[model samples]
Target: MRDILVTLLVFGGLPYVLKRPMYGGLMWVWISVMNPHTQGWGFATNFPFAYIIAVTTLVSLVKSREKNSFPLSPISLTLIVFVLWMNLTTPFAMFPNAAWNQYTKVMKIMLMTFVLMMVVHKREDIHKLIWVLVISLGFYGVKGGIFTIRSGGNDRVWGPVGTFIGDNNALALALIMTIPLMYYLMHDLRRRWMRHAMLAAMALSGLAALGSYSRGGLLAIIAMLLFMWSKSRHKMAGAAMLVLLVPLALLFMPDQWGARMDTIGEYQADQSAMGRINAWYMGFNMARDRFLGGGFATYEPLAFALYAPNPAAVHAAHSIYFQVLTEHGFGGLAIYLLLGLLTWRSAAIIVRRARGHAELDWAARLAAMIQASLIGFGVGGAFLSLLYWDVPYYLMAAVIATRAQVSLHLGPERRYARPKPLGRPHLDAAQTGPAKPEV
Candidate 1:
């Protein structure tokens, strides 16, 4: 029954998707991120819904009269280079078959990311994209949160099976990153009940992250919350909420969860932690030996034997930085890092220029929230190998689309203009008796 419902929804949505390619992009995002079809024990589990949607979206995109040009910017350009670099390294991968398989998967993600940027141009488009992302991921977050509460955090929360976030740790990080996007939506909403709903979702999502019992996720949430607090306009209110909520959430976790988190400080005693270190070393050593590195699946026993300090400690590169370095070499790491840096800078630029403009405030706020999400990804990603995850890339696309909108509204002359000053201007000193000091 679940499979039938999912199939009906996907097929039913196709006509609308064809009429409006952006709808296809949003539907594709929902399918990819939520993995709704995977919820059932049936044929829909292995269906190529994403592929069908992608092809349809592409065909519609070509035929549509909308402004479909890709937003070219430093971030997008760097992403293209990164993709090219990935392709360059694939031929030399230590394991060609596995490399090619992973390569195909990553290429598809990037293709859709680019498509999203092309189709999402207006402010309304960006809002719709955010709504899709929040709803899709927030489903897991809200469900996991409830499970965490019901189970009393005794059991870990997990994601959809056979997906990138299938693991408890990965799902936790994804939820942590999602909290800020939920907040972004909450801020934009005018209805009190809707805002309250988003607030509830954010709270539950945070709990869901804690319930996953991922130490990396805990640290990531901390970093994200701190950054979010700093970025928020209502600092005092934000501070009070953090002070009240964080401890209560932490206290609610079981002793076992606390013990697991404590292992972060005692890594030498944890096999998993040690294994990750060994994998990082292996990646670094491989990149040093081969300029192009060993490509995907290079974290195998053979490479570990050659490069890892403890050759017996063969493990996946648990860190995104190491994963890219090991697979695509030093150059690839550079370009990858460049993409992140450019994305961050672009968001900052949007915030700075869009401030004081009521019309562009949403873009400014969205950019700020994206930065907070990036904080979670950057910090948590250091301990997880989700280098090609769709969320971060989609966030990058959001930033690009947002900056483009800001530029369109501000025009070329004011695109890089400083934020307009707030408050009424004071009279000139010469005209106002040398400006009387405030009482």
Candidate 2:
């Protein structure tokens, strides 16, 4: 019953995003490439996804909590409990009403973060979301590519006025995620034409990323590509990477590309870096000053208004760690790092055990995607705030839920009765068995 609902929601966007690579990829076909509108133009926008997510979660929670105590990782539970604790213990959270509001707000994000992963319990659910991303983001990339070319290679041009969403970084990160998906498509493909088409789409997606002129995104995509290459253990793919960079050089080597590339050195010359250093200092001091909890999202604005150089330009701290610490104190930072570390640990287990078939392939593929998302979010968060974004947290939650599911299914001993080992066990072959990938 639950699986059916999840499938329906994912299938809602299949036709539109075939060529593009992100959820925002569907806006290209109907809306003008330059349309500035940002309303939900297709089926299952985030609002609807949120509703479907809510329904699916309630069902899963009710079913699981009623049936048996759902197994949870201590690392995940501790972090979640800590976040709740910080809000409850806020210094000025004296009124019950204020505390209730704060609790609800935190709960909202925490719940929203896990929606995708919670619904995606089976391997098929993961498959469905991959299609969702491919169809939605794929078509958007196609449209974006057309627009980028029309503008004489201006990478900053986002979507049509309002309908087309995604900054350059969003576009790039989406493409980075797509790389593994394409590899999977190729890996799973039985037809030559289908394999060719998937590779073509991958190329177009790369073009779209460069069109965004988002250097950080380009770098993030490169990181994911490097990960894929390292995992392949293939000499040809390694050589091809250098060959691929030639076309990219011609496309992005404009007057500003060099300066944009310098963003890699953000910690040195970038004002954003200096601001982060200042913000980190302030965040640490604030944590020492407010041991339990200081304030929620509302606190940062006040600090920026009072202490920042340009008070009128008040904004988020741009670092997830500092943002959580300043808002919820050191306790929040502890919880934040704990959750991330737990996720990485789980992902590592999955990656190490990824053999070559359906389940292990997914485990390995998702682990890489999660790793890339973490590194991208972490690196990008150094300059931009991602606390409010669903991508990072949702991916993290997926890692947790997926990890638990895979661990249960592939544990040394299955809980249920086991099948007798027939004449020769299928596990003998590296391709068919429990052997890990060479990576």
- After superposing candidate 2 on the true structure, give the runs of residues whose Cα lies further than 4 Å from its correct spot: 1-71, 89-106, 112-118, 159-165, 246-253, 263-277, 299-301, 305-313, 356-359, 413-439
* Local distance difference test scores for all models: 0.92, 0.56
Which window of 10 residues has the lowest lDDT sum in candidate 1? 411-420
**C-alpha TM-score for every candidate:** 0.94, 0.69
lDDT of 1 by residue, 1-439 (tens): 9999999999999999899899999998999999999899989999999999999999999999887998878898999999999989999999998888988999999999999988988888889988988988899999999999999999999999999999999999999989999988887788999999999999999999999999999999999999999998899999998899889999999999999999999999999999999999999999999999998777788999999999999999989999999999999999999999999999999999899999999999999999999999999999999999998988988999899888899885343578668988767768778655799
lDDT of 2 by residue, 106-202 (tens): 5665654443333445565455555555655666666666666666565564532323135566555555555565666566678999888887777
Positional deviation of residue 366's Cα in model 1 after best superposition, in angstroms: 0.2
Error of 1 at 15 (Å): 0.5
Give every collision pair in model 1: none
